[model samples]
Target: MDVNKTYKGVALQEVLTLLQQHENTSKVIAGGTDLIIQLRECKVTPQVLIDVSSLEEIKGIEIIENRVSIGAATTFTQLVNSPFLNNGLEGLKEAAKSVGSPQIRNIATVGGNICNASPAADIIPPLLVLDSELYISDINKSRTISLEKFLIDKGQVDLKTNELLCHIQFNNIKNNQGLGFSKLGLRKSLAIARISVAVWVEVEENTYKQVRIATGACSKLGVREREVEALLLGKPVEEKTMQLGAEALKTQLEKRLAGRKGMEYKREAIQGVFKEALTKATYLSKT
Candidate 1:
């Protein structure tokens, strides 16, 4: 990771100014868990590195007017220990805990995870189900975009040359609403996900009133499974109904990954993953 210049950012405005000046040559780094590896591998070759690890404006998690806002630089360990993420939002903690080991969790930023846009990122599926939004800024302008739209494709996003992702925001879970996450990895906490699912649902009298499903490692990027969500919505939360929903997801996977090497296995694996995630969501809604 050779860089001609590095700046430790002290303020948001200062960082933006630096980014404007170095637009094409600078990369914003928080935890550097992903960026450093990219740099070493020559996947990215920014001549200047701007360190925003100390920028207070982008380094905490808080609830603002019923919306949960996480500073882009907040670490996975922070997410795991946040009291505000409890109640029906335990799925976020579960996802954060599944990211690598403790050492990696200690510094891996949620913003970094999203910015890297890894198809198998452990944290993305859960965030996708939350319908998260990103706040991005440059020297003179700032904008907000839905996470789904912000993600253009694998290892790519809608971010501009000088813009930085400042934070992520989502609605807080309410009564009868719950979110659940489940991942199938080659090795626990070490290997990337083979498949992962996250479900956010609102249940009423054992029926699914509203449901959103997101999957990782099943496509070019973590994506919402709207077809499966539609299949489960307005349906009774019975084992048989849920099984049918899983079958629907399997069918969707079959079409999406047809002719791919892992298509058959993923088509089968998604059923169990979807069922487990939906089960947790329904149980949380009842509690």
Candidate 2:
């Protein structure tokens, strides 16, 4: 990638202050994973670049007393190797694994993924199911926002121009909760997702306790299939229920993407994927 300039060996506070100073002209470059590609494609150009890839405050995963918090600068490889994340946030770990080539995964930051806000971004579906929240900071202030309401549209988020993505946090699944993640792409390797789904369910006393089913690529954003969830609530986790839930999810997706091409493939593919995922989650939680 070609660039007019580069900034190195800068402190985190310096970068933040630089962004604050430049304001409209500044863009933070962490890992340069998405920014380089966008620049090469001539998609965007900013007068100033504030590099923060080496900032310690933006680079770890922690499971605190209440929730799991991952720094914005944490890379895919870090998430994949994290025991706490791998064991508890399997859906997120799996989604991170599904990203591009090894080199791309090594350099792509979680903050970039969230900020880029691609409708097809692989991790968004899993995060939506977690009902995650983002912590965004600027020189002046910081705020927390829900995942559902944070992503606005294609290539847009609730982030202010000078603000930075600090971290992402979400509670762990309850003791009896089961979670699963899957993505359908043109190829299993580097392709962007064509359709993705993540589901979580909690069972107690042989009955459905709570459920969150999220689907991406079909909608303008990742979405919860509420009608199907309504059907699954209090329903037994049997083959019949799985089939019904999956089929209903398919129907809802079809209705949502009514006029779009590729609906046929997405509708059929999602049913099988959702069923397999929900079944595995339910079974694994029992074991």
Query: Which candidate tops lDDT?
Result: 1
The superposed Cα distance between candidate 1 and the true structure at residue 51, in angstroms, equals 0.8
In the predicted model 2, the residue pairs found to clash are none
Q: Please write out the lDDT profile of model 1 over residues 50-140, one tens digit for every residue.
A: 9998889998899998899999999999999988776799888999999988998998999999999999988889999999999999989
TM-score winner among the candidates? 1
Show model 1 residue runs off by greater than 4 Å: none
Residue 25 of model 2 has an lDDT of 70
Determine which window of 10 residues in candidate 2 has minimal summed lDDT: 1-10
TM-scores, one per candidate: 0.98, 0.93
Tell me the lDDT of model 1 at 51.
94
Model 2 alpha-carbon drift over 4 Å, by segment: 1-3, 9-11, 86-88
Candidate 1 local accuracy as lDDT?
0.92
Per-model clash counts, in order, read 0, 0
